[model samples]
Structures are given as C-alpha cells and as structure tokens.
Target: MIDDSRTRVLARPFPPRRCQALFALVAIAFLAAPAAAAVHPGQAELVREVARDTGKDPAALDALLDRAQKQQSILDAIGRPAEAKPWSAYRPIFLTEQRIDDGIDFYRAHRALLEQVGRRYGVEPAYIVAILGVETSYGRVTGRYKVLDALVTLAFYYPPRAAFFREQLKTLLELPADHLAGPLDTLTGSYAGAQGWGQFMPSSIRDFGVDADGDGRIDLQGSLPDILSSVANYFARHGWQAGGPVAARAQPDAAARPIEAKDARPQWPLEQLEAWGYAPLQPFNPGEPAGLQTLAGANGPEYWFTFGNFYVITRYNRSPLYAMAVHQLAQAIEAGAGPADPAP
Candidate 1:
C-alpha cells in the first residue's frame, strides 16, 4: 500500500539529531505507560469477536490484549515495505551474488527433502529455495517482533489494512491452542505478522501449511520439511502450472499500448498482446493468457511478456518486481547449482 503518501514519507530526509530525539521521545512515551493500561481502542470489540469465533474465554483474550504493547516501529516499517522501491533499486537487493550462493547452499543442504516435496507438489526445488532466500535469507532474518504485538498494533491502529490484519489475528487465535509449544504472545515474526522461514501470514499458514515430516505437528520455525512442503503446496494450490514459462524477454513494438492494470495478473492473451505490439523472443502458445510488463532498470526500461506462472507467483506476493526477483533468483540458483542439480 505504498502509494504517493507513503512515498513522500520514504523520500523525506530527516536530520540524524532530530531523528534520534524523536525516537527517544517516542521510546520514553512507550516505556512510561504501563502494559495494563496499554489497551488499543478497538480491544473490546476484537476480544468479543475473537472469543465468539474461537470459543475462547473473553477474559483470557482481554488479558492478552492488555499485556500486548503497541509498537510504533511496526507501523513505520509497514509504511515502507521493500516492494515500494522502484525495480531499479529493488533488483539489486534480492539479486545479489551472495543471495544466489546462499540459495545454492540451502538447496544442496536440503536437496533430498526439497526434491521429495518438489516431486510430490510438482514445484521446482530452486524456486522453493529462492523463496526462502528472498523471504528471510533462508531463516537468517525471520524478524524478531512478537507476532501478537505486531498483529494487534496493525489490526487496530493501522486504518488502511486494519480489517485484513484483524482477520489474520482471528486466524491466529483460531489455530489449535497447542499449535505452538509456547504462549501465543511469545511468537515472533515480521512487523506485518508474517512468520517463520517462508514468512507466511497466519491465514496462509492455516490454509497451506502441512506436516511434511509426518511429526503430527506443523512447526514452520523449526521444521525444514514443513517449511519446504508448505511453500510448494502454496504454489501448487495457487495454480502454478508445471513446466510453464514464468516470463520471457519481449521487444515492444513502437505502436504498443500501455497495459491498463499495474498489477501482474494475466489479463491479455498472447495473441492479443502480440497484436498490441508486444512480441516475445520465444514462440509461445497463442491461446495462453499473458501480460506485458515494463520494469525500470539501471540501464533502461526492460520489457517482458509474462505468463500465467508469473501471475501465480504474484499471488504469493502482489508485486511484479517481487515475482520477477523470485523467478530470476530461482534461475540463478539453478544455474549456480550446475549440472549436478536435479532437473524439475
């Protein structure tokens, strides 16, 4: 949701001294307030709804809310997600040689399990590894904020997406009480409440998570099998066509018209796009649905004729830049893994 208003916040330059002073004040304000008195405005309604939905005790839910502290930092982070960056700046962050190397290492380390799940789910191991690398650097940086605090803060205080986060909070509450070994308030995740190696939101975990290792429990944080299988299952459920092209270089004809939607869903057929002056370098099925995307790069604008697989990737993340990064990173990892790596 980084629109013009959020862009202004990101672009605004603040002096170090002023930033330090402002942070200090905010910190002091947060620290001075007791947790018992830190209830969000919509806490009661949230408690009632969650209690009704999950059949949990209202007092218990209320106590969780009372103990949850509001984090302004989460709000600040949400306002400036990585997807907000232009493709020029966004490409380098995920397309580094180091990330690709790490992805290769990750793929090799879990090659057997990944291959097993890939075969079952019809997903490539490199793509799964690339998602892990891009999401949390293969769990090296899976966030540190308490999941409860992040979700509650965003659910009540953040107006733009409050309803969405509220739904996620409900899903988190509705999870089996013993899903996690520890207390709910102790679970840690991204500022937006995405958790574990795959950075899945609560709803996604509930929907797509699987116990791949057959341990009778789904532990995304500690179980590599579950993480890999969950990612593959998510892709398969989202209609990831096996062996389909994700994207291809395209030369836009001079008379090409700009696409109407900025989002990456496949709205145009290949034949229609070709008629509209976007021609792919490789021959493609004319009946297949596709879209033309122009990415701003350091050199210039690069165009691509994206296919349905590309659209499916976008379901995991709405940004076309993110989808492309994952696609390219997967390709790089496959290339780096050499001929020894198993093919999809």
Candidate 2:
C-alpha cells in the first residue's frame, strides 16, 4: 500500500499550499524572533479557536503555542529538496541490499505480530512490510526530524498547506495523554509530520490509530504491536479487502493512449476503462469496482487495473510511484524472506 499510513490519513487535513522544507530549525527561530513581530499570521487566533473547540482553558494553549512556534524551523527543514530527487535516483537510495536484508530481518523478528495484525486487519503482512520498507526501511530510518517542529512549520509557516498542518497541530494538542506517551518520545518522523515505522501523522495517529499491544494506548515508537496494529487499522479504515488482489497486469487496447491521473479524487470506473484496451490476465469479478493506472517503467510503459484495495494503498501516499514502490517492495520482501507464519 502507498501507506497514507503517510498521505491518506494525513489527507483529512486541508490541502497543502506550496511551502518547501528549509534547512534551518524554524522552531528555535520562532521563539527567538524579536518579541515584537507576530511569528505566525494566525497563530494566536488558532490557539483561541482550538481552545474553543476542545473546551481547554486558553491558558493551557500557551504551552501549545510555544511548542508550535518553537518548532516552526523544524517543519521548514523537512522534505529536503535533496531528498525529492526523481524516483530513478530515490529508488536506489531505498532499494538496497541492506534494506532487503533489513526487511528480511524485520519480517523474521515480528513474524507473529505481523501475522496476527494481518489476520485481524484483513491486510497482507507483505504489504505492511513493504510499507515499512519504503517509508522507513523497516523503521531503521524513520526521519530524525522532530514531528512537533515539522507539523508546526508546515502548519504555520508553510503557506501552501498551513491549514492542514494547523489541523495536525490541533490534533497533536488534543491527543489524549494515553496516546501522548510523554511528549519527547513521540517527536520524530518524516518532514510532513508522519510518525513511526508507518510514518503516520498525528491525526492519523488519533483517528485510524490502534493500540496493537493492547496496552490501552497507541504508542507508535516504542511498541511494535502498536505500530503494526496502527498500520493494519489504517488499511482497514481505508477499505482494504481481505484476500483481494491489489493489482493486475494488463495490456492496453490499440486505441489506448496514456493519460494523466486526475489531480483530485479518483472517480473513474473500470468497466468504462475497458474500452481503452485495459484487460487483465485474470478476469476480476465484473461486480467488483476498479480504476485505470498507467505507469512509466525503466524501459517503456506499464499498466495495471487498480482495484479499491489498490486505491486504499494510495491513501498512504498519493503518487502512483509511491503506491507502485510499496507494491513492488512488498513483492521483494515476499521473495527475499518468507512470512513469519503459514499463510492464513
């Protein structure tokens, strides 16, 4: 799955505007800014709004404001341009022998939990492992950026999607103490505020988040149970179908021409797409719904009939590249290392 386990869960937030990750820590800068200037355009107002929404005393918001302001620089530093290179370059950075080795090791270590989560969530362990592989290399590389700083920077300073980040900040503030697990421990992830092995943002951490360990709290960092469970919960919530095929190889029709995927929501239907020569090796149940997804390959082109489950994977990350990477990575993990338990 593309994991919104990075993008999908985080999607509930408002769309991004156009803020880029700056190298410096904006959190420190926000606090150090001259006492006179308003560091964020609507920060104070936002705090008040949060207070009104959550019924928390406005005074309690001071800490939140301080935290948000202090972390602005961190968000600015997230999503480094250096890290945004083309997939040809980015793919090699992650699809390494070490990653493959680590994927094997991760699968071996969490065999039981992976299987259990898979069974309960109706998602395949391979897909989950692939997500971990692509997102953080089996948790070996879950970003060093402090989540608070990243979220706040994107929320307040990043104009393109400040509203979305603001919502994440609000979610972070409203997280129950049970899920908080103390502030310092939860402060790390991708530049966009995704956290844990699955790189879930705060709101996702709250809504689709699951307490895998059954400790009565979901702690993405410390507990594998919680992390795996949270991932499974994310897929389930996004409409993952147990035992359903995620993708299928297809040959396009003579008239089938490459078309760009829509920028907004996906509403295209499979039956209509058949006119374009998108036929699969195995006939899917006609009753099932599907979509058209064409991809560029190393040589020429690749096409697949994406189903609802495949679309659910995209919720983790919007890019078809991201979804494909996860799908391929999961396949690799399955080939390189066997599952921890007998297939259910």
Candidate 3:
C-alpha cells in the first residue's frame, strides 16, 4: 500500500532514484481508490469478448471484473525489469553465495522427488530447482498484487502490452474456476500476473501445467510434484534435449569474428564457430548446433556457447541473462550438492 503522505510529495520533484516511487504514489492514489475501483470503461469490450469465448455469463464476468483494483506499482515494476541490467550486475543478483547454498539445500531435501520428475520429463532436476530458486526464492515470495489486478491493470491501462495482457486476462477468465488458486479476486501472483512457484502466466498454466500428483488438480503453489513437474514439462515441450549440454564458457581468440546473437536460438555449428575463432573450453561434438553469447563480465567480456537446452530455458523467459543465471545457478548448486547428490 502507498502512503497518503507520499502522494503529497507531488508538490516537489523527486530525485531520480525516488522517481519510480513518486510515480507509484501518484498513480496509486488515482488508480486504486474510489474513482478507479470499477473496471476501466474501455474494458467493456474485454468483458463481452471473454464472456463470448468462455460461455460464461457476461454479467457475472463483468461483476467479477468489478472487484479488480488497478495497481500502479505493477506498471512501475514492468517498466524497469532487472533484465535491463548489464550481465555483470545481473549475474551477481542470482549467483550470490547465499542463494547457491540455499539452492543446494533445497535440491538435497527434494532430491528424490525432483530427480523422479526430471527423469519423467527428461529435464534436469537442478535446473528445475534453479527456476524455483530464481523465480520466487523457493516460493518464499510470490507477488502480493491480486492476479486480477495485475492483469487487468496491464490489459486495459498499459498501452504497450495491452493487447498481450488482455489475452492473458482472457485466458485466465476462460480457465475453469478449479484451475485458479482461489476466487479470481483473491488469486495472487507476480506483477505480470504469472502464478505459482514457476510463475507461469495463465496461458502457460493452460498449456504446460501438470497435475503430477494425479489428485485431479494442478496446484502449483502447494504441490511440489505439480510445480517441479510443470516446470520440467514446460522445458520438455520447449525442446530441452535429454542429457544435452546447456552452455559452456568459451575463450574467444583475439581475432574471433565478432558475433552477436539476436536471440538464444542455436544458429551455428560448433565446428563452424571454432573456425570463426570462438573456441569453447570443453570439447563438444563438432556438428552440435550452438549460439554464441558475449556478456560484459566484471573482469572483461565473457564468451559462452549456448546450446539447444539453453535456448529452451530462454523460452521460459525471453532474456538470455535470465537463462544464463538459471544455468550458472544450476551449476553451482550441482557442484555444492556434494556426496549427497546423485547423478540425474
């Protein structure tokens, strides 16, 4: 909740660091309260569209949407995602000693179950655990905003991604009531309206979510099997190759052809990359397809050959930095798991 006093600060300009907070305060004052309480006037079409698509009562859906509160903080968070940071800064956020230790502990505790899910889906257990550790700190913190609020605010008010979020909001409404965490008004998730330990958006839930426990429900919040399995399933569906390499640090020769990856997808064969002057430290199959990623490291530029599995991780979140963080964190956790951890 934003403080009323903070809203009064609009009388003066906020410093650069405080600018986001200032925007949040002003927006919240106008967005969350009496005037902005109802669904945005523009959302009348969305309610009708969702009702038509889902075969639900239009009046019911409209009344349900009335409960949503527009959140300005969500807009603020989206505008400045951490992925915008340089790789040097981004790496430290997820690669800290504490997170690594905790990841090891979390993995060891759920080793058997995670391994089972991994083998079933052909996705690595460490990576699955890493997703949880990175997305929500092993479910310690999911976002506080109502899923309804987050999606609706973005769908109706945030113009840049309004169409996309409107679809997410529609997908959410179309899902059977049982699929939700609870009532639409109460369901909570990330600022993007992604739900569960995996932080899946509504469409991801509809598409890749697994009811691994076979209890007739997909409970990503409370069911470890569901969370871990759904994540692994998403990876598998996105083309994670079983037992395939994810990424490897490379030593680029001084004359290494400056290669820039437009995306994480593998676009070069290992042999071709070597011929072009970027040499991976480890020996990989010469014919293996890979992509080169150069990161601005603390020491200098760091080169890495990201393979198909790495690209699969990137599908979960489009940022290559996010995929790299998950990759390195998974590696660190695997190394620290010690004698207790068995091979996947």
Q: Model 3, stretches more than 4 Å misplaced?
A: 1-38, 339-344
RMSD of each: 13.1, 16.3, 11.8
Q: Could you arrange the candidates by lDDT from highest to lowest? A: 3, 1, 2
Q: Is candidate 1 or candidate 3 better by TM-score?
A: 3
| Candidate 1: tens digits of C-alpha lDDT, residues 78-178 | 99999888899999999998999999888777778888888999998889998999999999999999999999999989999999999998788878853
How accurate locally, in lDDT, is each candidate? 0.87, 0.73, 0.89
Model 1 steric clash total:
0
Q: Which runs of model 1 end up more than 4 angstroms from their true locations?
A: 1-38, 341-344
Q: Model 1 lDDT vs. the true structure?
A: 0.87
Candidate 3, 22-44: lDDT as tens digits: 88899998776674434575678
Off by over 4 Å in 2: 1-39, 67-90, 184-186, 263-272, 339-344
Clashing pairs in 3: none
Top-scoring candidate (TM-score):
3
